[model samples]
Target: MLLSKASLEAACGRKTIRAAVPSLVSPFQLTVRSLPKQQTERRLVPMRRSKAVSVQNNFSILALDDDPIMISTLQAYFQRSGYHVDIENDPYRAIERIRKTHYDILLLDFLMTPICGDQVVEEIRKFNKELFIILLTGHKSMAPPIRTIRELDIQGYYEKSDRFDQLELLVESCAKSIRQMRTIHSYQNGLSAIVDALPAVYQLQSLEQLGGTLLETAAGLLHASSGYLFLKQSDETPAMHPQKDPELFCTFECTITKEQARAQYTATVFPDQKTIVQQNKMSAPLFDTRHSMIGMLHLVLPHAPQYEQVQLLDIFSRQAVVAVHNIQLHGLVRSKNNELTQVLGKLRDSYVDIVSVVRLMVDARDIYTRGHSDRVSKFSRRIAETMKLDRETCERVSLGGLFHDIGKIGVPDYILLKPDKLTFEEYNVIKRHPDEGADILAATSFFRDIVEIVRQHHERVDGKGYPRGLTGDKIFVEAKIITVADCFDAMVSDRQYRKGLGVSAAVHQLQQGRGTQFMPEAVDAFLSLLDKEHGKEVLSLYDTLPSTI
Candidate 1:
C-alpha cells in the first residue's frame, strides 16, 4: 500500500519521496516499513549544498507520467533537491513542451496508457539526442529492456520505492556528468569559431575592414555585448615607439549604447596595459611579429568568462595581431605602388618630349617635309577613329605616324633632299627608313606598342612590301591604318621633288591601291573620315604649306 501525501511529507520532512500508489491499494496504509535500513540511512545524509545550488542555476528537468500522483511526487522530490522541475501528466503534451523549451534532464515514467516509455523515448530521440533521460518504473520487471535503453540512449533507470534515496543519488550522478559535457561542448564551439574567423581576418586588405571583422569575431568568440578596436598610428613617430599613444581606429556595438562604450573606452589605458579579464569586461593587446604592441581590443562581455574562455580569447588575440600586421603591410605596399606610378608618369612625359625634339630635327632636314609627320599623325588618328578601333589602338596609330619617317634622320642628306625622282638604289634606301625608325623607337619600352607599326607601315596587302614583308592579316591593324594615312598625306603635301597632288588625285591614288598595295579596310576608313567636317579641316592644313621647296 502507498503512504498518503500527508504521511509521506511527515516522514520525509522537507525532502519528498518519489513513490507510486499501486492500483486497487488502500491509500491509508503506511509503507514506511518496506524501505531498507541502508536506504533509510542514506536519506538522512545531507547532499552537498554548493552542488545543489549549481544544479538549480544551470539545469532544468521535466517529469512526464500519466499518473498525477507520480508526477506530483517526482516534482516535489526533485524541486526539494534544488533543481528546476516541471511536471506533465500527458505524454503528448510533455513532448510538445519539450520541443519548445530546452530541458537538461527528463524524469519519465515507464508505463503509460497510449504510448509506452520506449515509444515516448523514440519520439523524443528523433529530434533531440542530447537530452539526459532517466526512466522511472513501478517495478524492476516493468522497466524497459536493456537493449531499448541502450538503443534510445536513456541514461539511467530507477524503480519506484517507498524511499527516494536511490533516485536522488542517480540524478546527482547524471548532473555531474552533464556539467562536464557542457564544458567540453562550450570549448569545442569556441575553438570552431576561432578557426572559422581566421581566414576572414587574414584576407581583408584595409584597416577599416580588418578592424570591423576583428572586433565582430572577438565579440562573438566571447559572446560579448559590445566591443571596440584601437589601432596604433603615428604621423611623426614610429608606431612601435614607446612614447606613441594608441589611436581609436573603429568601434562596433551590439546591445550596448555608444555613450556607455565611449565612457569605457575613455577609462581604459591602451598598448601599455596587459590583458585584463574582469567581471563582464575584457581587454587584450594586439601584437605584431616583432612583439611590439600594434592595437588593443576591448569587449564588454555578458558574464565573467571562465578560464577556458579566457584561453580562447588569448588564441584569437594572437591571430588578430597577425591580421593587423598583414593589413598594415598591404597599405604600405599600395602607397609605394602609387608613388612609383607617379614617378613613371613623369618619366614617360620626358620620353615623349625627347621624341618630339627628334621628330623636329628630322623635319628640319627637308623644308618640303616640314609638318609632314604632324599631318600624317592627325590623319591616321581620324582614320583609326572612323574604323571604330579601340582608343589605345588609335593612339598607337597616331604616334606611329609621327615617328614613321624618323629614320630619315639616318638617310644621307644628298639622297634625302634630291629634287628629282629617286633611282632604284635611293628608293631602296628610303624603304630602310621604316626598319631604322622601328630600331630607334624599340630602345624605349614606352614606344614598344608603335615599334611594329613603324616597321610594317610600308607593308603591302599583297605581301610585296619591305622590312619583313608581312601580308594582310599578318600586319598589325594599327600599321595598316598608318599606311593609308601616310600615303594620302605624302601624295597631297608638296615635296622638293614635285608639286602637291590635289585631294581628288590623292583619293584616286588610294582607290587604285586598295586591297593590292594598301588594306581595303584602311582605305575605306580614311575615305570615310575625309567626308566628315573634322577631316576637311585637317585637309585644309596641308593647303597652307609650301607648294614647292
Candidate 2:
C-alpha cells in the first residue's frame, strides 16, 4: 500500500516510517541491499550535490506512481529545483506520456496496483532506451529482481521514505550523463558528414579547387572560425608555403613529423596563434600511402576541442592524403595531354610548310609556274568555303591543292620545261606525278589522311584521267575540289607558250567539263564562289599575274 506524507501522518499519527526523518550517514547513500547477487563488488555512486552544480537546469523529468500524492510530491520538489517535471498516476498512462514527450530522466514507483514499476520500465525501454530510470519502492522485497534492474538499465533504486534527498541526487546525476552523451553524438555526426562527402571532394581534378574544398570542409566540421592549409614539395624538403591570404585569420606553417601526424591530440593554442587569445587548434598531416608527407591542414577553433573532435580530425587527415594524391595525378595527366597537343600542332604546321616549299621549288624551275601552287591553294579554299565544308575539311582541301603538283619535282628538267607540246611518252611520264606525290607523303603518318586526295586529284569523273583513272564516286570529295580548282587556275593563268584566258572563258571551260571531267557539285560551288566578295578578290589578284607573251 502507498502512503503520502500527510495521509500517513493522519493514519499512523507520528508512528509511521513514511513521515519519520531517515537516519543516514550522508544526504544520499546506497544501502547494503543495493549490492548485486552476482558480484561481491558493490557499485558506488557518489551523490553529494556540488556547491557549483553545472548541470542543465532546463532538463526534463517524468515521475510516475499510482499514488497521486507521491506524484505531486515529486513534481513540486523537482519543479522547485529548476527542472521541468511531469507527473502521472497510471502506469499505462505513464508509458503514453513518455511516448509523447522527451524526458532526460524517469522516476517510477516500484509497487503499483495492476502493473508493477518493472513492467512500466520494460514498456518504456522498448521505445525510449536513452531515458535514465530510477525505481522507488516501499518494501525491499517488492523491488524488482536484480536481473530486471540491470536489463532495464535502471540507474538508481530509492526505498520509499520521508526524505526525497536520494531521488534528487539521482536526477542530478542523470542530467550530467545526458549532457555527455549529446556531446559525443554531436562529434559523431560531424565525422559522418565529412566521410560521406569524400567521393565528391576527391573527384575534384584541379589542385586549387580540391585544396580549397578540403580545407573549408575540415575547418567547418571542427567549428573553426579560421584556418590555413600548407602544401609541401616533398616529405624531406622544405614546403613551398603560399603567402598568407587575407582570408585566413590564423596561419600555421610549422612542420609536423610522422609521429606528430599520428598523434590524436589537439593543442590549446598553436605557435602561430600565440599572439591572439589562446584557442583550440587541430593539425593533421596529409601524406600518401608512400609515406610522403606533402601537406598539412591546420584549423583554429574558438574553444578547446573534445576528445572525439580531435580523433575525427586525425581520420580526416588520412583521407586528405589520398585526395591530394589523386589531385596530383590528374594534374600530371592534364599537363602531358596539353604538351602532346602542342607538339602535334607544331609538327603539322611544319609539315604543311615543307609541302608548300617543295611545290614552290619545283615551280621555280619553270618561269610560267612560279606561284602556281599558291594560286591553286587559294582557289581550292574558296570552293570548299562555298560548299559550306567544316573548317578542317576546307583546310585539308587547301593543303591538298598546294601539294597537288609536288610530284613534278621528280620529272627531268628537260621534260618538265620543254615549253612545247609533249609526245605520248613525255605525256605518260607527266601523268605519273600524282602517284609519285602520294608515294612521297605515304611514309609519314602525319600526312596519311591527305595521301588518297593527292593520289586521286587528277582522276576524272568519266575515268579518262591518269594514275588509276577508275573514278566517279570513288574519288574523295576533297580530291574533286582540288581537280576543279587546278584546272580553273591553269586556264585563266599564263602557261609557258599560251596567253591567259580571262575568268569568263575559264568558267565556260568548267561548265563544259562538268559531270565528265569534273564533279558537277564541285563545279557549281566553284562558279558560285567566283561571284562572292572573296572570289572577286581572287579574280583581281590573278589579273596582275604576268601573262604569256
Candidate 3:
C-alpha cells in the first residue's frame, strides 16, 4: 500500500512543522542537529527520567524517517531528553550516514515509500552486527513477523504515538546493551595481547631472568599494583655448590612490609593446585602439565579479575614451570660433569702407585740397583723444577725414571746376575732394555707423555748413545733431564763388578760430559740442584741399598 504524507505524520503524531536548522554542515550524507528550541515542554515520567538520565547522556541516537516534519520533531524531542540525535528524511541515504557516523541506537521507521525499516536494518546488519536497533511503526499490522524481528536482531519495538514515552524508553534500553558489548570487546583485545607476548617471555634461559620478566609482565597485564612470585626451594643445600638458591621475588608499584610478605608466603599451602583463592587478597597457584605445583603468584589489584583472566594466569604459570625445569636440568648436567672429572683424577693417582710397585720388583733382580730407580726419580724431578719446566713435564720425567729399568725384567737371569764382565752379546741385550721399556709403557693411555722420556733417556747430545741414538734437540727436554739424572745415579751407585764412583768423581764426570753426552741446560740444572739445602739430605736418604732377595 502507498503511504500518504498525512498518514506518515499520523504514524509519528506530528504536524508539518520546521525548526531553525544549525548553520554548520556535517560530513555525513545526512546530518540532523538538535533544534534551536525544544518543541515539547513535556518530560519523561519521574521513574523513567531517573533511570534514563544515568546512561542517556553517553549514547547517540539516529532516526530514519521519510517524513521531513517527523524527522525534525524527533531531532528536537530526543535532544531535549539528553541524547545526541541525528535524523535522515531519505531512507536510502540514511544507510550511508549511519555507516559514516557512530551511533549507539538506530531508530528505524517501519513504513516507508521504497524501503521498510526491517529491510534497512537487515542491510545495516551486513556491515555492523554490534549496532543496537529499534523498529518504529504506526500500527502492529504494519510491523514484520515475530521471526523477522528475531532474525534482524533488533533490540526493541515502539508504536509511534503522541506520548513518545515508549520511544524514549527504547532508546535508553539499547544504550545499556551497547555499553556491555563494548566492555566485552575490550577484554578480548587485552587477552589476545597477553597470549601473543607469552612466547617471547618463555624464550629466556636463566631462571632469575625468566622469573623477573615473567612476573613483571603478568602484573602489568593483570592491572595489578603489586605481585609476589614464590618458587619452591629445592631440598639440596645451595652452599655446598657455587650456584645460589632461587629466591622469592616481588614486582610492585608500592612498598610492602617484609612482615606482611612473610605472612602471605606462610599462608600458601605447601603443594598448591592450579586454583585461585581470594579472601582479603588474591592468590593463584602455578602448575605443570602433571598438575604439580611449581610456584604461586599473589596479586593486589583495584578490581578482581574475571574467571577467564584466572585461566590465562594459569597458562602462563605452566610455561614458567617448563622454563624452570630446563634451567634445573642444565645445572644438573654441569654438576655431574664436574664430579666425573674429579673421580677420574683420583683413579689416575691410584694407577701411579701400581706403576711404582712394579718398578721396585724389577730393581730387586739387581741388588746393586735396589734404590737406583728411586734416587734417579727424585733427582729428575728436582732438576726439572730448577729448569722451571711445567709441572706435567716434571711429573712425567720423574715417573719415567721409575719405569726406565722395567725392561730389565725381560732379560735372562744369567746375564743380569753375572758379576764378571759381560760378552758383546750380553751387553747388546742390556742396551735393548730402553726400547722394551718404552714398548711396555706405550700400551697404556696414561703414560702417553712419559713414553718419549722412557724411550730416549739413553740418547746422547753427541748422538753416540743407545736405543735410537737420537741427537741433541731430537730428544725431548724431559728426556734430557731424566738422562742426566740416570747417568749421575748409575755412576755414583755401587756396581756388581766394581766399587762405586764417589760423589766428587761423579760430579767431575758430569761436568766433562756436558754438551757432549748430556744436554748442557739439563746438566747445569742438575749441578745447581746438588748445591741446594736439601741436596745432602736427598743423597744420604738413598746412600744404602736394601739387602738382595
Q: List the global CA lDDT of all models.
A: 0.76, 0.72, 0.70
Ranking by lDDT: 1, 2, 3
Provide the TM-score for each candidate, comma-separated.
0.73, 0.59, 0.50
lDDT of 2: 0.72
Candidate 1 error regions (>4 Å): 1-55, 65-73, 89-93, 111-115, 137-143, 159-166, 184-213, 234-246, 249-275, 364-370, 382-394, 407-436, 439-445, 473-477, 489-508, 520-548
List the lowest-lDDT window of 10 residues for candidate 2.
37-46
Candidate scoring better on lDDT of 1 and 3? 1
Q: Give per-residue CA lDDT, model 3, range 350-433, as digits (tens).
A: 766666666787888788888888888888898889899898888888888878887787788899888899999999998998
Clashes per candidate, residues 3 or more apart or on different chains = 0, 0, 0
Which pairs clash in the backbone of model 1? Answer: none
lDDT (Cα, tens digit) per residue for candidate 1, span 1-549? 123322432344232223221221111222333443235334433432222433355778999987676676667677767789999977898899989999989988877757877889899999999888888876545667777877898877766665566677767667887888888988899999999988898995556677789899988888888878776652323333234434545676645554554565556665444577778777887666666565668888778878778777778888887776666666666667888989988988788788778889999888888898988888888888888889999899889999998987889998999989999999989889988988888877889999988999889888998878889799999888888888888887778788878889999999999999998988998888777665668667766676552
* After superposition, candidate 3 runs with Cα above 4 Å error: 1-223, 230-291, 301-316, 330-346, 385-452, 462-474, 497-512, 528-542, 546-549
Give the CA lDDT, 0 to 100, for residue 277 in model 1: 78
Instruction: For candidate 2, write residues 328-403 as lDDT tens digits.
Output: 6665666678889899888877887787677888988887777778888888888898889999999889888888
